[model samples]
Target: MYRLVVLAAAVALATAEVILTLHDCGSHDSIINSVRVEQCDSEPCIVHKGQDYTVHVNFTATRTVQEAHNVLHGGLGFISAPFPLQPENACQGSVTCPIVAGQTYEYVQTMTCPTFAPSITVTAKWEVKDENKQDIFCFNTRLQIKS
Candidate 1:
């Protein structure tokens, strides 16, 4: 009875954090369990200008990672530009390097709301890659920047 209660609670928590309708990079990417942005809980996550926000990505390691790197970009309509991936070293936060295969991990990254950015909607692409430049996972999500 205790185990069942714990399991149900886990299921509920997972569902609470899940960002459905994940946008995938391609066939090479791993399936992301969920993505969460700081403060916002629903679609078109709103971020305030000049404030910092963190994004959490939950996924299982598809392969052993000796080292991991971050790739990030922002898109608006047909135009896309690279966004600086803070720390760039994917292993620095939440989960560290030399990640073992078949294990679950949460990857965390933080970005500052661009003060000069127009109050507009954009999709951000976030990717984690292995040492050889192969993707562990890549996904895009909508965000709204506000003043």
Candidate 2:
């Protein structure tokens, strides 16, 4: 269905675009409150004292509901790398239909960071919404990668 596609696309975009800076959305602090590092291959990944290396970071986002709904199906995604989300598709700030209540959406993304510092943190953020831009839920997470 077209609605499903839009919802999927929104989530995909948030996942793909990794260049987003780690600044909270203006006046939307509550939208991205909790960010935890669920799992990681390694913590404080150590790199050579002065050498640089590449490490991959993975994270998740669990947003809260903004409005009462029977369900909240499709949600958007976010990334901290320079990668682009759904580069082939052309949708920005788009919306899909509302989902029933008590439903949670999950998304995953991978990014490359320099093992330059002792460690680096990556965070993801996104929202669940409907076709009219009504926000249902939002989420964010942080991953600590050591060098």
Candidate 3:
């Protein structure tokens, strides 16, 4: 009976680890009010080897957001090398030069999961900056990928 109880407890703990969550880390700016990963509602989003995902963000910027930088990092913390991402225009080919203050941004991007994408957790971080390169909004989310 004791062995059975120990095994049950171990199984429960292992199950709990699978349900990772994307949460807010420290932020220098408060422009980003909320972020929701449409794919994953209550659990860590899972990405297939080759698939696309949509991320919706609601923010209230005090000033215009001109350009943004994105960095993809592995789950092993900052010591690991960051994946390279091409710079993207914040406007997304819209006529708007600068994003309006009180607006929400919806971005749909292909995961482009590498051929050797490890079956591990990863975080994608985005930061929008003004002309002075000062951060206006920054956010990150954790997700799991299956290679």
lDDT of 3: 0.54
What are the lDDT figures for the candidates, one per model?
Answer: 0.78, 0.32, 0.54
Candidates sorted on TM-score, descending: 1, 3, 2
Better of 1 and 2 by TM-score: 1
**Cα lDDT of model 3 by residue, 16-131, tens digit:** 42322335553333355566654454455677766655455556656555555444555557654455444454454321446556565543332355656778877766555555
TM-score for all models, in order of appearance: 0.79, 0.26, 0.62
Candidates sorted on lDDT, descending? 1, 3, 2
RMSD of 3: 8.6
Q: What is the Cα-based TM-score of model 3?
A: 0.62
Residue 120 in model 2: shift from native, Å?
2.8
**By summed lDDT, which 10 consecutive residues of candidate 1 come out lowest?**
12-21
Which parts of model 1 are misplaced by more than 4 Å?
1-20, 27-29
Off by over 4 Å in 3: 1-22, 25-30, 83-87, 93-95, 102-111
Error of 2 at 17 (Å): 24
lDDT of 1 at 52: 83
